[model samples]
Target: MIRAKTILALLSLAAPAVAGDIPLAPPIDCTLGETCFIQNYVDRDPGPGAADFACGGLTYDGHKGTDFALPTEADMARGVSVLSVAPGTVKATRDGMPDIAMDRPGAPALDGRDCGNGVVVSHGEGWETQYCHLREGSVAVRKGMRVAKGTVLGQVGLSGRTEFPHVHLSVRRDGRVVDPFDPASGPATCGRAAAAPLWQNPLPYAPGGLVGAGFSTTVPGFDAVKAGLASPATLPAGAPALVLWAHAFGGRAGDAVAFEIDGPGGARIFEHRATLDRAQVRFFRAAGRRPPAGGWPDGAYRGTAQLMRGDEVLGQRTVTLRIGG
Candidate 1:
């Protein structure tokens, strides 16, 4: 989180105001709910507890920014550009931070660089934006460089105090943190559409969503799935087991993850549902079966996964696998 005192200091060199609200553009190149998803929103709760703009549990205590997260580290390696939300001059920047999860061994102590490898742009009129957790050596703009809306600043990475690959965007006005989704900063506005959002195109709020799904010969580790190495394009007909897995985020207790597999001729081969016992930032569930006496049939197979909250489907994905065809 960017501190108010620091923001006040950074704004001292800001350019003159252009007047009116600061219209923001989508700060990332990927599509929401697909290439990327909103992992966390600004913490709207004033107490020690946390709440998102929607009065949901998609935020952490004192979280000051919106986290747009990629599904896997593979997506980060492919390079997703982080763009500027509005026209401004680059007031400050930091680069060269290693891209590593904060919880991983050998991670560096933050000291005060919580906004690791970041860029701060002065939009004037007491308004400014901060982009954090950019990839090392990826910062493209220099101090005092003018930028327009959609200008590329850097790529999202696992730098700074982050456990995942994401770009944290913080908006501020007059040195106070502002939720772009709800600038009114009132609890009454929770779950209601913002009368005027900062983004040029307002984004929809998803309580939870599927990140990715795929087929594996056996149950895979969560780390492998997150690293994009769990799913294979094809499996042998005699494989030990045929497993289908789904990765998802923003899960709450009582939410359910359902998995189904259809073999050649659309025959139902496997089906299972797992209920979450507690809220999780991200979770994965898998179901599978061992081959029968004749070994698995050689043909195409389809797998479908859904994240359900009661009868409501929060998200769903389908994957296909070819077996010795």
Candidate 2:
């Protein structure tokens, strides 16, 4: 297998360097501890097989960009900036694309011309980057405008052919698609990829793991949560139902999963524990409970989930919701 260092050496010997090491910065300003994550990366394989930045199946066929996905549209509604990764001039942009989540009924159908509100910037030396799925009306720069690295271009959104809230950043060299994580910008074999990564700092890549955890006023299906549907910001005190849900990808048959909801008063309102009997590309689990007859005490409700394999915790997430009114 060709290692990263080997790829870097080969690249230096084969051609002139492009100014210096990859001068790109992350396109988003979000923390990546447990909530926000890179859900997918540019697929390297030219065929139907999948591959991610770390040489995994976290990507799908024909996917040509890195998807920095957020937990929910509620988070997108709160505003998450998509930043410019390198100093460049805006070459093109499209805006006014409705920032409607895919699961919302009657969401407008998109065409090839609709990348759903995006910006394309051209850095020197034939390097161009495209940021896709920006929030409606959030394009901050116009064509021909100059921008510095880390400049705020817009907010991430669920637009175009997307099912989740994320900014799909596509990098290109001389109009050819490139994978920033791969030195040759080509397919990765095994877990080895070629030379210097594009990010100024190391960007963490998540395998098929926990995508998000959240509390909803109504029970949510797996697709609903992924498409950011019915995400309530605040739960009414007397609401009939409150559900805690989690979404995960690349689940194996023997994985152990747990979900729980805790009331404001620290009472465990709902809990579920199970072991998957079949492998799944994506899986979801939820547990819900209604408030007592007297009504829920207004404060905080916590939802938590954990995916386990034997004694090892593969992934875990926690979400808190406020109960008012």
Residues 153-205 of candidate 1 have per-residue lDDT tens digits of 99999889998999999999998998877676655245465446666665767
In model 2, how large is the Cα lDDT of residue 312? 55
- How does each model score on lDDT? 0.86, 0.75
- Worst lDDT run of 10 residues, candidate 2, spans 6-15
Best by TM-score: 1
Alpha carbon deviation, residue 55, candidate 2 (Å)? 2.7
Residue-by-residue lDDT tens digits, candidate 2, 1-325: 2122311222212222345544678899898645577777788786688776556666888888888888776788889999999999999999887877665786787868457889999997878999999998889999999999999999998777777788999998888888876646567656553566666666554444566777876777666676555446687888888877777765667876788888778888888887889766567877777778888888877888877656555677788888885
Task: Assess every candidate by TM-score.
Answer: 0.92, 0.75
Which residues of candidate 1, in runs, are more than 4 Å off?
1-19, 191-193
